[model samples]
Target: MTGQVALVTGGARGIGRAISERLVKRGMKVGVGYSSDPTSAENLQSEYGSDRITIHQGNIGARGDCERVFDEVINAHGRVDVLVNNAGITADKMLTKMEVDDWDRVVQVNLSGTFYMAHLAYLHMAERGSGRIVNISSVIGEQGNAGQVNYAATKSGLFGMTMSMAQEGSRKGVTVNCVAPGYIETDMVAAVPEKAIEKIVSGIPMKRLGRPDEVARVVEFLADPESEYITGQVYSVNGGLHM
Candidate 1:
């Protein structure tokens, strides 16, 4: 993967950060895309050296921002060989309590944002006849969560989108795959109350929460050129919680 370029949306923190670091360790130049803050991303670039890591800031929910970010990445790195659609937002609310705005916002950032970035990357990769696109989903998407209807919907949507995109990209040597991670130690998961987290962990067969690097490992595998024959599949990292 040396000299290859990768664009990782939401690459500034949590699971995204682990993925970005892993790719860089594997000798790939990474474009780290963050929605609002650039501190983490910039810090990563500093640690990895600016030549190996480039920071890009934009709201993935907007098509215009997606276009500009994509162009910026390409302009900085010359080409993109892998795209990780890891950017997403969640507006948790019970179905009845959920406001229209809450649903719309989550849908826009999680589903629509992924589509915008993937669509752009797909075109570039298909034209080049080689590429990998990995979508970061969640275990909640597989097993619907109580207060996360909107989030679950968008994450589950990626499954169908992955299959269809895989078929379309197969002939062109591009692959699309989804990674559904269980409760990992991310800032998002950390926000849950301690008691809630304990309850969640007790249900996992492994009797523990997953680590971000654990999820990133699967993503790293999927992004490898050796994974060309393994598209349109979902690799669960949920520690037997959902499977």
Candidate 2:
């Protein structure tokens, strides 16, 4: 793990932050990609050290950004063994009255962002013949949400891609999987209207939001060597919300 590396998108905060930190602690070099958040990036680098953690500021939705982030990881750590496609944005609205920009933005970041990062990871990982990719999807993707039509569509599409890539990657000694998390206790969830949270929790048997570290542990499991036999699967962290 000391020589291996993990590239995590949207790593400045929330689930991404925990994944980045966990990887770093595991003695793996981390390349964190963030969009429009220099302060968060700087803070992460400062905590993890610029030598061990390289922070790349760019939009995950762009191909160039994906290329640049992986390039830096290669230059800094020599090889990329893991990729966590966790950068995503949400534009919650009913399809009837949703803004066009909102729809485009959600699709761009949630769906295209995952594609760009995975494409880059595929290039490097396929070449190495020993790599892991864990995509961060959403429980809403599996069990559709009323107000998040665009976001749900994008995430659901990711699961299909995950299965397809897992088949392709397995032949090359690489594994591809997706992790669909439930309502996690992140700043984004904290911002959810309390009444809305109540409504959301009412559906979950757990009756509580999940923690960032809980999701991080699942990412760690996927990244670990023990999970080598596990691929083409969707691991849900939604506390029985979608089961």
Candidate 3:
């Protein structure tokens, strides 16, 4: 993916940030899109400098905001070669206990946000007749979580979207795929109770939580030119946790 122009949504931290840095290190001009967190974006800018990195602030669920970020990067980099839909939110609750707001909020950001970014990126990539898109899904999306019904739903929806998009983009020389991360060591996972975390690790054959870099590495692979022929596939980086 070297020399490719890539955009990473929710790049302020976690897997998104790792993906941004990895793509940048590979010689790509990266667009770091975040809903907020100027400090993190500023840090990325410092590392990459303004000439190579463009920091965009916007809500991924908003089409206008998505367009703004796309335009910002296109105007600066001249084109978009890759798109990573990594923006998502979690509103954990059992189905019986989930509030309407919780369900709506998580769905809006996680599922709809991916659609918005892909929708906008599709327009650009379709025009160019080439691009790569990776959506960050969750293993929970495959195996439902006890208290994350809504979150799981959205993520699972992303898998469906990924396949459909891959079919559409294939005719245009674009590729779409998804990465399902299992228990990545991000701030979100850090919130789980110690014992619960231990239980999670024990279930993994590797006996450890996955790292953000683990997820990012998979994303980078899919973004590669050789990967152009492989689309609509779901690659799991769960350390045997969800197999």
Candidate 4:
């Protein structure tokens, strides 16, 4: 994958950050799409070298921003060979109490954003006859969770979208797949009440929260050149939480 260009949304922190770093270490040029946390984004750029990685600051929820990020990456790297849709947010609320804005924002950013980016990247990949896309979904999407109707909806939406995209892109040699991570130990998971966290860990067969790097490694495998036969698949990195 040396010299190939990869774009990772939400690449400045957490699982996305780990994916970005892992890809760079494997010798791929990377474009990081980050909405905030300039410090982390800048650090990635500095550590990876400007030629190896370029940080594109933009909100994935907005179509125009997604366009800009893609344009910037192509302009810098010549083409995009891989895309990781890792940009997402949680708006936790019971269905009745969930505000309209909260639901809309999560859908816009998590579902629509993935669609927009994938559409654009698909076109480019089609022209080149090759590409890879890995979407970061969640276990709650498949199993469902209380107080997370909006979040669960968006994450589940990714599964259908990935399967469809994989079918469409498979004929063109462009692969699309989804990764459903369980209770990963990230800042997002850290916010859960200690008791709830304990309950979550206890439920997992591994008896522990997963690390971001564990999820990142699964992404790496899907994005690799050797994964040509794999498409329209959901690889669970949830420590057997979902069987």
Candidate 5:
């Protein structure tokens, strides 16, 4: 993996950061894609050195930004061997309280953005006859959350998209998979009300939120060249919350 190029969207922090660091540790040249705030991306590049990592500033939600990021990665690294669709946002509100803009924003960034990036990367991967794509989903996608209707829809949409793309990619020696993480200890979860968080933790069998690295490890495994046979599967990293 030393010379391979892996593009990880929203790799500036949280789970995305873990994934990028893991890939870099395995010696892959990484493209750290960020929608805003290059601080974390810059840090990763510095830590790994510019030769091993490059920061691509762009919004995955926008088609033009997606194209530019993909093009820049190819120009910088020659080829993209792995694509991790880890960028997402939440505008959580109960359906009754949710505004149209909130729904559109989440869907555009989470669902549409995934499609755009996957399509852009798939073109290169299909031609190369080898590549890996991992879509980071959420457990709420499978088991709906009351205030997360829009977020859940986008995440579940990723499941169908992953399977269909995997079928198309199979013949080309490329694999596409999804990872649904539950109650992860990230900044997103940190904003939950204390009472809500406590209730959530009590419901989980693991009695704790999962670490980003735990989820990242699964992504790393799926992104590996040897995991070509494992495609269109959703790996749940929720500490057995749903199982």
Candidate 6:
């Protein structure tokens, strides 16, 4: 993967940060996209140097912002060989209590934002006859959480998009795959109450929360040049929680 170029959305923090650092260590030049938190982005740049990493700030929910970020990455690195659609947000509330704005905002960022980035990368990759796209989903999307109807729906929607895009990209030497991560030790998971987290961990066969790097390893595998045969598949990094 040395010398390859990749764009990782939400790459400044949490699991995205792990992914970005992993890819950079693997010898790939990465474009780190973040909506906020310039400090984290700056830290990554400082750690990896500009030669291996570039940071872009934008709201993935907006098509214009997505376009600008994508263009900036292309202009900086020449081309994108891999795209990791890891940006997402959660507005948790019971179905009845969830406001229209909350639902719309989640959908806009999780689903529409992914589409915008993937569409741009897909076109470019298909034309170039080679590329990889990895979408970050969640276990809640598979099991359907009580207070996360909107989030679950959007995450689950990635399945259809990934599979369909995989078929289309097949002949073009591009692959699309999804990674559904369980309760990992991310800021998002940390926000969960301690009691709730305990219950969540007990249910996992592994009896522990997953690590961001563990999920990043799967992503790295999928983005490898040798992973060409794999596509339209979902790799659950949930420690047998759902299997």
Best-matching candidate per lDDT: 6
Ranking by lDDT: 6, 1, 4, 5, 3, 2
Model 3 stretches with alpha carbons more than 4 Å out: none
Instruction: Put down candidate 3 lDDT per residue, 1-243, tens digits, no spaces.
Output: 667899999987989999998888988989999987899999989988988789999988787888888899899888999999999988888889889999999998999889988998988899988889999999999998899989999999999999999999999999999999999888899999999999999999999998899899999999987887899999999999777
Local accuracy of candidate 4 as per-residue lDDT tens digits, 1-243: 887889999998999999999999989999999997899999989987898989999999999999999999999999999999999999899998999999999999999999999999999999999999999999999899999999999999999999999999988999999999999888899889999999998899999999999999999999998899999999999989998
Q: Give the C-alpha miss distance for residue 88 in model 1, angstroms.
A: 0.9
Model 3 gets an lDDT of: 0.91
Error of 1 at 17 (Å): 0.3
TM-score for each of the candidates: 0.99, 0.96, 0.97, 0.98, 0.98, 0.99
Report the error of model 2 at residue 111, Å.
1.1
Per-residue CA lDDT of model 1 for 1-243, tens digit only, reads 888999999998999999999999999999999987778888888999999999999999999999999999999999999999998888898999999999999999999999999999999999999999999999989999999999999999999999999999999999999999999999999999999999999999999999999999999999999888999999999999998
Better of 1 and 5 by TM-score: 1
**Candidate 2 residue 59 C-alpha distance from true site, Å:** 0.8
Residue 158 CA error for candidate 3 (Å)?
A: 0.9
lDDT assessment of candidate 2? 0.89
Q: Candidate 2 regions off by >4 Å?
A: none
Steric overlap count per candidate: 0, 0, 0, 0, 0, 0
> What is the C-alpha local distance difference test score of each model?
0.95, 0.89, 0.91, 0.94, 0.94, 0.97
User: Which lDDT tens digits does candidate 6 get at residues 66-151?
Assistant: 99999999999999999999999999999889999999999999999999999999999999999999999999889999999999
Give candidate 5 misplaced runs (Cα > 4 Å): none
**Candidate 6 Cα misplacement greater than 4 A, ranges:** none
Model 3 weakest 10-residue run by lDDT: 59-68
Cα misplacement distance, residue 209 of candidate 4 (Å): 0.6
Which has the better lDDT: candidate 4, or candidate 6? 6
